[model samples]
Target: MDAPRQDAWKDEEDLLLATTVLKHIREGKTQLEAFQEVAEQLHRTPAACGFRWNATVRKEYQKEIQDAKNSRKATRTIYSSSKSSDDTPMSLDAAISFLKEMKTKQFEDYGKENLETQLKKLNEDNEKLREELKQWEAAWNEMDKLVHWVREKRKSESGV
Candidate 1:
């Protein structure tokens, strides 16, 4: 008897898995919790989801995961150390400043990616235009030669 094949992971599932894991980590929750949540949504076993995340998805999103961890740690440290009202506001200000900086950087990175994609598309378009121009030039050269040949043949046949 043939064994049933396992279902392949979709891109959306991978994305959801990664984000859920990151969310759990940032909240100081366990991987098992994240796996359970993802499993319910994806209709897979929690163990299977955990294995997939640990083996592949986590590696692919290591940088993002680390960033989330660092952000959460910084927020925790700021809140925990603030005792007085003045210190509380100062810590809040620092957190706000950090958030603004992150937002700005995210926008800058997005803009750079957009520009690179546009540049690549424009280069492709320019190459296509160059090829078309070469074809048109060849056709014009052939027509010019034919026109000259006909004129000489007419003159010779007319004894001019």
Candidate 2:
């Protein structure tokens, strides 16, 4: 449960995480996406960001979170009544408008450096996962071999 001293979350970083999460909430995005965004900016893992939020930062931002959720609900209500269904593709104009809206909310808030950080984090995570998968596979193969040996031993003992 203890974070390394060098990886401690600072006040500014906590504030950044909170605000980013709130904005994502207002935009109707998942908290995990917010954690991923903050992970890059904070140079930490998304899981770390999420843990910090749930364990400490979230308590301080309850009111803001509620407000963001309310705003998101209102926005959804406005869009939900539209004739266009999810199965149908949006028109080019609608797509443009949606992207523009997202740009105003996002590009103005986060700097260019954040994206490079996210990509770096993603690469690191990918390598870590690959290594972990290899370890698990090796252990599984060993277990399979042991089980096969045990079964053969039993069969030989039974003269089958």
Candidate 3:
């Protein structure tokens, strides 16, 4: 009646999970979305991922989380102060445009990060392929040498 062992999180997985959670927070999206995405990538349950993030990863990034919260609070204060002074709220169009701009910027930043990750993975794959090719080449050369040795032995045995 022993319990099964769970897989440990690697550094790369932890980094990705942390980044995804931070991105979702910046975008004002639910943590569930981040958890689901990380879970799918890491082949873990969303609940497990979420629990790990809250229990461990979140604490590690306390400064980052606090900074984001402070930045948001400052933005809200600025907006509130402006509204109070003007006695008028931001127009619907202006608010929508601002939101659209923020979304676009977030998307661009995310895309850049994704590209960098992909490039790193591709570079690693390329290095692995090169090593495999070198091994194959060495194997082929050894086989060729063996074939030549066998042919020479047969010729000498046949007196040719």
Relative to the true structure, candidate 1 reaches a TM of: 0.49
TM-score of 3: 0.43
lDDT of 2 by residue, 87-106 (tens): 65644534554667777767
Candidate 3 lDDT by residue in tens digits, 29-62: 5789999999999999999999999888899998
lDDT of each: 0.83, 0.84, 0.80
lDDT of 3: 0.80
Stretches > 4 Å off in candidate 2? 1-4, 82-160
Residue pairs with colliding backbones in model 1 are none
Query: Which is the winner by lDDT between candidate 2 and candidate 3?
Result: 2
Q: What pairs collide in candidate 3?
A: none
Off by over 4 Å in 1: 1-6, 83-160
Ten contiguous residues minimizing lDDT sum, candidate 1 = 84-93
Model 1: per-residue Cα lDDT over 42-150, one tens digit each: 9999999999998889989989999888977776566545353453454444566556767787889999998999999999999999999999999999999999999
Residue 15 miss distance in model 2 (angstroms): 0.6
